[model samples]
Target: MAARDYGQYSGITRAMELVGERWALLIVRDLLVGPRRYGELGAGLPRIPSNILAARLKELQAAGIIRRAPRSRVIVYELTPYGRELEPVVLALGAWGFKALDEPREEQIITPDSMTMDLRTAFRPLVAAGLPATAYAARFGVAELLIRVEGGELDVSRGDGEADLAFAAGPDIRRLISGQLAPERAISTGVVEVLRGRGELLTRFASTFHIAA
Candidate 1:
């Protein structure tokens, strides 16, 4: 059973009952990236209290949104098929929330999983289909990602690699993604520092991954 009841029969209410708790959707967000051990989940969400993490995991398991399975001889939590259905929903929610993001508070930290999803959310597949295949080694705060775009597909993974462009940005990369900051301006102002590759590819990156403000 869900942990709470609102005495309403609406689907929205039921969904809220299942995942509306603080940090519950964030757990789902990370799992959407891939399976994670309990410790890994905790590490990804360093702000969540350990007890709350344990309780949320139990509630999610009970609700059948996630399950534990043996992976490489270690148990990890992964989304069930039904839970995977939330991917588009989570992506849409991320896009909707993008407009509200300003600057990151000092306590906020970016994680690879979160950045992966953010790229997925902002990917313009049709636009990318017309562009040359591109690879980017990007850093947002401490998180490093290798991003590749070919045709209408995007692949993002942790760590660095050879790339057409390499750059580092803080949370202000949102400005570039939202088209509020042009590539030239971003580089000139130090909002993004080019570590390697041609600076012009940053324009392609901006065009390929954008969310209109």
Candidate 2:
């Protein structure tokens, strides 16, 4: 580490304060795909300065969000299980940031979490442990969707046609699911668009999601 004049924040405050910087989220985003060597993470995030990267990684380690292990002769930075648990939040942030960016015509191929894949991953954690959906369907458009239940997992897609529950939330599914915006409030405010679903089924599906505090 260089002899830079860093501010005197307390250990925990310092850790949170470090990640509070601009490029810190991007550093974690690189790690979310999997582990990476320092250079690889640097390359993936072009805008981050090398020194800043090192500093953030150090802070993340200090905070117990990441750790490095030896591979071959070099060490690799990987998220701790504690850090990996933040993947949903990271994905949510990515989606939200993309929406705030410039026009849709840019054709930038950045995908945070796939709607189809989210369905699969979300169910694996809660409902369907092993098997794939017995029946699956989706109606893809500007806002893609997938409703599926595999093995024993059941999730309704947020598209047209019959759904046990429909989510017509425009742009911010994460906010709604994360409980930042109450589901009923979102529906009432016209922020999220929901479709048909029985009360029992809605309760069952809500159990599967991981909402943020």
- The model with the greatest TM-score is 1
Runs in model 2 deviating more than 4 A are: 1-18, 104-213
lDDT per residue as tens, model 1, 68-169? 999999999999999999999999999999988987898888898999999999999999999999999999998999999998999998899999999999
Residue pairs clashing, model 2: 132-150, 133-149, 133-150, 164-197, 166-195, 168-193, 169-192, 169-193
Give the backbone clash total of model 1. 0
Score residue 172 of candidate 2 by CA lDDT: 50
Per-residue lDDT of model 2, residues 61-174, tens digit only: 876788998989999999899788777876666445533444335433323223443343334344444433333222222544556555565555444554555544433545
For candidate 2, the C-alpha RMSD (Å) to the true structure equals: 9.2
TM-score of each: 0.98, 0.44
**Relative to the unseen true structure, what is the C-alpha lDDT of residue 108 in candidate 2, on a scale of 0 to 100?**
31
Model 1: runs farther than 4 Å from truth? Answer: none
For residue 154, what is the lDDT in candidate 2? 55
lDDT score, candidate 2 = 0.56
